[model samples]
Target chain A: MGRRVKVLLIGFGSVGRALAKVIALKRKIINSRYGILIDVVGVADSKGMALKAEGFDEYELLKLCEVPRSGVNLFKPYAHQGVDLNILYSNTQPDVHVELTPSEYTSGEPGLSNIMYAIDRGAHVVTANKAPLVLKYKEIVSRALSRGVRIKFRATVLGGTPFISTLTSMRSHDVERIEGILNATSNFILTEMHEKLVEFTDALKMAQALGIAEADPTLDIDGVDAAAKIVIISNILERPLKIEEINRESISRVSLRDIIDAVRQGYVIKSIASFDVRGGKASIRIAKIPRSELFAQINGVMNGVRIRSDATEVVFIGRGGGGIETAHSVLDDIVSLSFEDS
Target chain B: MLGRRLCVVKIGGSLLRDSKSYIESAQKIREVFVENGYKAIIVVSAAKGVTDKLVQVAKGSQEALRHIVEKYLEVAKELNSVKVIKRVNEELKRLEIVAGAINRSGVDLSLYDFLLSFGERISKILLVGALEATGVNALELHADELIVTNETFSDASIDYISTSANLEKLYSSIVDSPTIPVIEGFIGSTIDGRITTLGRGGSDYTATAIASLLNIDRVYLVTDVDGIMTADPDIVENAKLVRTMSYRESLEASLHGAKRINPKAFEPLEKFYSSKLIIGSWSKFGTEIVKEIPRELWGPKVIMNRASQDMSYMAIVGEGTSSVQFIRNVLEIIDRNGIEILGLQSYVHRPSLLVYVSSTYELKTLHLLHKELFEGV
Candidate 1:
């Protein structure tokens, strides 16, 4: 009621659909609960963009998500064809830009370009994509902070279930160590292999069939997905950690013999993301965890984050990476943002 | 939902697959258990279809069982847990020897249960280790240790009194602490401590038995089904979730061939305690089964059909077996329908009874019986 906040969302994938649903369904609740009005005025996809000066209809957006190709042409008087980053800044100005683009780990170009446009337009930003952060987190975070604009990415770390927020919340306490199973894809692949006795290729195929893994599951199976997650942890811990610097161990190294051997020894083989803060330096690695350890219980695509603080080693786990859960996470950020504005 | 209570979760074989959804579900379940300060006792089935494959091996030659052993070890390798990989190989070797004896000596059906038990034994070993790997305080309790049954090999009835005592002793070691107890589902031990099976989809029974016996609040049956639906989703186009159901309804629904809860599970639950049961997809909110239902808008007391009929008999299953009053009510409807009941088998361990009927009158009998018993007076 005080001031209407406008949001611009990029991409219309599953996460986008979920995000739209959350923003719409939880709007009244958010308003009464948090006392902030959020107006999603701009939405875009790979094929095109839609712009409404006041705000787009949430119901219409949800309906569009159901159709093939994601309702690119369905926003009456507001739907525009052919998406451009410039439209976010030039024609329909937005206060916050939500980046939900397809990931490009190597370059993070799509996400990077969107962030640049959002910053240039003086818009604060929230993102669920790990690509942009994996590639240029230091540069992007610094730029937004320097401009006095917030860059909230709770979804990036553990899909908005209060993971990074919880870790950062415990900043007052000494959190010297952090470890977990951060990559759902790798976990899924491994879990499938163990349960079904399916080969790696078969497990990967099953993951793709479920749409949990990308067609090219390199990032997940190769441990890059966990790497990106670890990188985020390092940054949160204020450690100068680079993707290349971290010692990576992919689940691909796990042979059929390895799994069989591990089972024989009464142990589980979990792909673990661990961090050690010592000598004022932090290092992250992917290890084959033993069943006797806490990390071993983590199965399938679940992401578990354990923080070893001065008091207790708290573990947080959930749907680590899913469009629905990630979307909910982004909604949490918006709700928090709305509260802060109030 | 917020407070920490003792909770038992039974993960179905489908959700136990080595898939991201399965692992993620496991992690989420474990997280919820820890976050709310609930002491979790997780009973896990073999990964996905591993049990069936192991059963195939158990049925075949010893060479086939050896192959099954290799297959299990391969899974440990995939996760990169060398310790478990080694231990499972040795255990499988012993199982392989048993398989050899079964094939060489007369293959006793009881041996099938013993040989097939390895699948879940290996699974518990893997799951507990996996939990520990994630920094969750998890311990493995061999299924046979806590789940006590009679000498019946394949479909053994549980020794509830003994099982409860064993559970108490085991819980004494870890209860009130953060340690999670991982157990093998569907497998129990004879009074003499030999391996036995509760039956297919029987792991849920084990979980329910433990949950109810321990007076836990709820038993989470994490399965492939999203929740209890009006009909099998594959068959009914308009099938939607029945979000909240009574224990009676759940027993009826599942016994009438609902994809989630095993009918046998209702026995231990109904007898010792009426714990809440939530059966659903591995990582999603599911239908909650309460002990009692308000009759306001609820439809029917039971739903039954001959899921499968042969020349020999009909299978009439649902909740309320021990309730002779309820049983009499159902039989009256069947009698009024003029259906010929060939054989009726009821388990003291559960609230389900299977009635064998002549195949010729099966359809007519079920149709009339559905209206009389399910749509009820």
Candidate 2:
């Protein structure tokens, strides 16, 4: 039998659900392969929370996924509705607190508070929300360190592609720069404009229609999403920078004519987010990279990050927007945390 | 189960475009049914452009496949519910498997229909999520589990007997529960368990079929447009909303490209029960399609226009328009004006007549028909 790790998931949104589903669907394989049996003891959403002292079974986890607002209904045998996170933590006493709340960059509330509270209570924290880290990375990390609790946020940047993890593992090598297409939505819209010869607005509409972009796409189109990722990356590289310091340029002004003209000139317009680690600078802008470049080849809702280090320039390309992939990354982080503790 | 007051609401794809609408829909459902002490069954289409993207995925567009998955994820994110988001991911995974099979094996209609079913399947989860977010206890009821059909794949006709039995059983199981059941409209499954779709605009058919089976009094078809209009509002600036019309009138209008209601949607209602069908948007009630129209309200309920590059016509739809006297009078007027009628079609059973003429004469024909059919009334 593998080691048992009890998890309490907050914010039952796409990423959270994806993690639950992944745990349910790949329970046996994950347990056998990683020697860890994850037990989700508590789940909470905006409306209510569900707690089980004995931890939830695979069937319970799946049933939780089918419920409407909260997993509270799934705990009908011992139903407690409208329970807050405080009650959940005290009752369930989870080993790891999984924070999947929506990013609130201004104050990082809910996620920030949730992370701090979990760490204060002596539980490891794994987060997919980037807002808290973007706003107060140092404070959170220092708090986690002081408390001797591991805080893993592998799904925060690049939709859980292990970009940060890879960067962290390469600590021995002095990386000169880090740059690539960080925002999948912006990259997808730019690709659509160039390939379909449509106006920027039309490209955005297509992206929105396809679910590649958010309803309020200002964060992505205006370079804020990528900038946030850059900020996180800068923090990871030990070159912490504020989002306000990044030179940002939105993709909104990249018109159809611009795309067509660029295409004719053997160049492709990519919404590139780059961090010059040595200079301690970050910027997100629409760059006309040559068609032959690897960055230009990365299209649609796929993210690519190129790491230029003293050893080599390595690129990681993967699906950048969907919840399943992100959830998988979160799970990976959870497993890695479990291994570290062991 | 028999005495429970229930109404089926079919929400169109256009309404699922934004997050506000989902909340608004939940609020509306709460107001119209939950608060009023009625059980509501919601039938939803994929968010706008989801089905198209799924179809493209079936055609082996990897981009479309990504889009389909992301669209549901995006909706799940907006709803911000973990259960729904997880369910959406599970459904998308199944859809991706089906898509992968289709891409490898070329085009198979059955597989394609199965692929398309994911749109409504995912939409149902999102809607239920939103409804629950709004404090409504909602459960997703997959139509395939309730509605049984033949193996016709894309446009399968419902096997009414089995479907009615399944629906009744399903209702009986959840009769005591307070939760609202949300269903995918355009998709179903065969008795043998193969996935199927009811074709385009089939969501309307799904609602009507369920209403007929349950013997519900009214089924609301909520769409982006107000309802069946006097004409396509783009062409006729003064086009008014059709407040009430007979099912036959609606059917006729639909056949002539009204597109407000699916032609097949009237079949189950016309045959089995006398359910009142209401079509409208969220803000206003638009049209009521009843089993019968009163004799006093029988003439020119709606004026529908159809135009092509070379040919065009104005269709006058009303119970009175099917009368011999009305058609004769219309022909006489056309003769008196020496207007060329390229083609004309009328049936005694259908309460509408199409007068096709040259494309140039479309507006003139509309004015002439309006003068004769609507001016005095």
Candidate 3:
């Protein structure tokens, strides 16, 4: 009934496939509810790129889910394999560019370059990748603002469980401080240590087996992931914090003995990530929280963020680090961007 | 790949103990199906001890995680493909991320199912690699993407209509593809995409569901055992394999503590489409369960000892088990043997008769019934 929102998906990994599935399955519902139909015009993965001017059909989208290589194979007779991203973008004019490339925190190469390219090309950007925002949040935000395009990164934190959107919506209430379990992997490991009486390394190993920890878990265990989240939340709160400025304490030092001792003292050791608006500082550390506290009860792969504001103290808790869950948030941003244009 | 006969083969967790078995299984698939011009959809479970270890990992045993990674890595090494090994490593890395999250976060049943799924997911990848190494074109198909279930978490039931629709759509897409789709069993997903597992021993259910959904003729449930035995092999030295059984009889055996086939696996065959279920090991063609039994085969098929101390004999008779003549014959046998029946129950619809007796006369009763029903005939 309304204008179709043309979209270009930059990554065809699990999260990308998940987003495509959601769009295909929920197309009718989305169109009826939001008055906009999503037309996925282009999709690019490591293998190559697939572009269709008339938008991919449901069958093609389903094929993309099973494609072993790049989604370019989904286009079959009409696909342009191994096409460069810049050329692909210029050829297929999509209004919204959905970036889901893997995060590279240190340099933010691919995600940073991809976002900048999309913004420069006058296309609105919606990203689930956190690296670009963590490395260059202010620069990217300012660049997008200057270009008169919008950038939504709700999926960057809490796997798209309304952490950023909720905080931004409460901007009218003058928030004083924010603290909770921002990183699900670290929180899960800490909970495992306390409940199962295993050492930190053991807990981390279990997390890895369960697909909750990355192979290189330094970011999660060393508090870098939480610090990045704090930086993003701080930026959104108008405090603008850098990754280097945030003080972090890794969870690797936590032991079963420490957990037992804390429990004996009627407390739980939680990997708490916090931001103090007054001090303009963010910190991630293992804090002994009371057993009855909200953060103490938040356990495995689930993230909880407590916001203390002048109006109310609110706690947002949800299952984190799922491809589909994160994709839902990315889709929500894409829909929001489309609505803004209309 | 066009117009090839399709068959769904399920490999039980027990069969994947060592690298040799992985190769053996690929060879078996090639010999029995692929060479015969049939396309195989392989459904696999986690390695024998992997699921248990993963459950431990979920509960916070970091040691279990190392074993899981090492086991898969070892299998990948045996496969010896750089692409396959890299894929396995990537999956292991992803698994670490999930496990770490579960360890840090408190356990939710839904999340636990998601955690448990890595076992089968990783196994599927390894098996696909092994199959490809054996020169069979194979692809890993995550069941969570195809099988739709309710939000019941650990023990979820499949939504037949939606699942059937998804399977049909998936089949149509891959029907012409040359690659054999290797799928993970025991795990599916809610419509909203949260992971949910069909309960333990659910690989058979997955295989059967796929077979019936695709309207395939037969499904092979490859396990360690030869097939459903006449009696517990450990208890009875002369226990013999039963070649054929009916769905109702299998269900009866399952309910009375026989762990051959999952009871849920029969739902698709009984409700939607019919398929022959062949269960056995590589060396033996053990049991074949069909939709209907012929008239001659309609009698007590399996004599099971229901309990150890206060022994009870559950006679799983075939169709017409509730007939007046059949009940009379059973009573006559017990009376003639001078066996004391403490309690007795029989269902008109189901072909099962439970006879309770004292521990002393349990063996005697089983012997007499077996002699009268099976041997005498």
Candidate 4:
């Protein structure tokens, strides 16, 4: 038998649900190719916790995805209400803990507590949640380092493509600056506002309808989501900055007249996240991009990040966000962590 | 935002014959709607004969994909929008891939439906380009993602509840937005995500459904003809336009095989919002269809000469054709003229009355009915 990796899923929202579907679909290929079989042994939602030490099969996992929001307790046979995390952890004994809770910036909520618990149990952690990392990057990473248990969160920054490994592995550490369209919601809104001459509110409504923006899009519109990504990047590059350090202009200030005026000047207003590492400053600005540039080409719900290093500059673009896209990134982190010298 | 008025418009295939035609239609939209300070949601059909071309490709026709790509790109190039050109090229490439994949896997009805969707998909993108070119800001909405339908691939039935919810989510805010969204007509996706078509002449259905579901009041269906005519202009020497009719009358006329309107287009209009439909060319929007008109305004709006399998029919379609007085008038005229009637069909519930006659008198019957009921000549 190949390496059997047991996973525990916490928080079953859009991303969590997408990750489950993706894992079920790609399990066969992953098992056959990498000689590793994934078994999701436990799932936790707001209402309750569901545990099956033997792991959920494909059909059950799919059925689990169909459950109504915060209705994990409704899942039969293995579901229970108000189950303690300690007992839940001991029951499943998961090899890898996957936390996909919503990112509540202030307290970092359930994701922060869940990640801490997983680290204490010496279980590897793979996260799609950015709040905890953006809020407590050094504390979390150093804790995982001391525990000798790996923590991978590539999904937080890269939607469905590789970026963190590439950024972290690059030599010659003399990095100058970084600019990216990191947040999908803001990018989609800006693209609509500038290209289609839509107002900021209407563009945001479009984003919400498209499922690119959550019901409460405060973090995205306020530029915290992009700043969070920058903070993660800064921490990775060993030049950490507080989340508050990034001065950001809310995209809600954008108007149809502003976009129309920008078009007249052969420019498009884009929400750009810039980190001047040399100057030790990070800011999210409503920057005007020339029509002929690569930045202007990144429209809709696509993310593009450009790394300006000492000798060269590199750009990485991928889908900004979707449960399935981020799930693929999450799966990669799991597979790579399984292959580590444990 | 509520200060801006909204209407839905469908640019028909007959009008979109060439690149210049697309630009002209865009200019008409700008002059009529945008300049008049009304925001519009435009539903566009494929260029004339493109669906027929797609139908041939669906039946294993070879090398036709390139021609389709060129046809769409022709308009894109004229509009001079790089963004539109790029989108059209990408969609065309996807079409080619879908076509190639179907060829490799062998063709099926579902895949055939998918192949057919490209015509409208490409048309919608080009229309957006054309609209933007005319200084009217517009965007393209993908119908396959938004319009929900049943799994019947070739002749799909729309799930109005799901489709309405989706449309309301994406398009409900259009009045607040500056740009008009141009969407593809005659195409939708199944609840399980298979592409589908809403049968032939279904573009009108797409337009009316969007209007009714979004609670928008007016729908303009721009065709080559001026409006709903009394008789086929080719068949009768002096046929006049039917200026106004009810939704029920329009649906009845269409069911009797009227040429201009689609029967399915009235379902949501009558069932949901009862939006008014304007069926005509851009310059003269002649035929106005409301959910209901005053009873006095209910009479024959169209007379058609139809035949199926050697049986000839002169269909006199109107709002009050089933009324006792109107039926008496029609019978008296037929009797006085000595017209040989094979059969007759009329129900109190229906708005149309059908009279079966010999093929020899089909055109004569159509003309006689048109003169008496419409022209009063």
Give the number of the best model, judged by TM-score: 3
TM values, all candidates:
0.51, 0.55, 0.71, 0.57
Q: Sort by DockQ, best first: what order?
A: 3, 2, 4, 1
What's the DockQ for every one of the candidates? 0.01, 0.04, 0.11, 0.02
Compared with the true structure, what per-residue lDDT tens digits does model 3 show for residues B280-366?
Answer: 987887899999888888877788767846556655456766777888888898898788888887878888887888878887777
Candidate 2 error regions (>4 Å): A1-342, B307-311, B335-338, B375-377
Residue-wise C-alpha lDDT for candidate 3, range A189-271, written one tens digit per residue: 88878777888887777776555787799988888888888888888988888899988998898888989999999999988
User: Who is ahead in DockQ, 1 or 4?
Assistant: 4
- Overall lDDT per candidate, in order of appearance: 0.70, 0.82, 0.82, 0.83
List, residue by residue over B47-110, the lDDT tens digit for candidate 1. 7766677677656654556556666676666555545566566567657656554543344555
For candidate 4, write residues B338-359 as lDDT tens digits: 9989998899999888889998
User: What TM-scores result for chain A when each predicted structure is judged separately against the true chain A?
Assistant: 0.92, 0.95, 0.93, 0.97
Task: Give the per-residue lDDT of model 1 (tens digit) for A195-303.
Answer: 7675676666556644578767788777777778777777777774777777777777776667777778877677777777553333334355667776677776677
Mark the regions of model 4 whose C-alpha exceeds 4 Å error after superposition.
A1-342, B1-4, B172-174
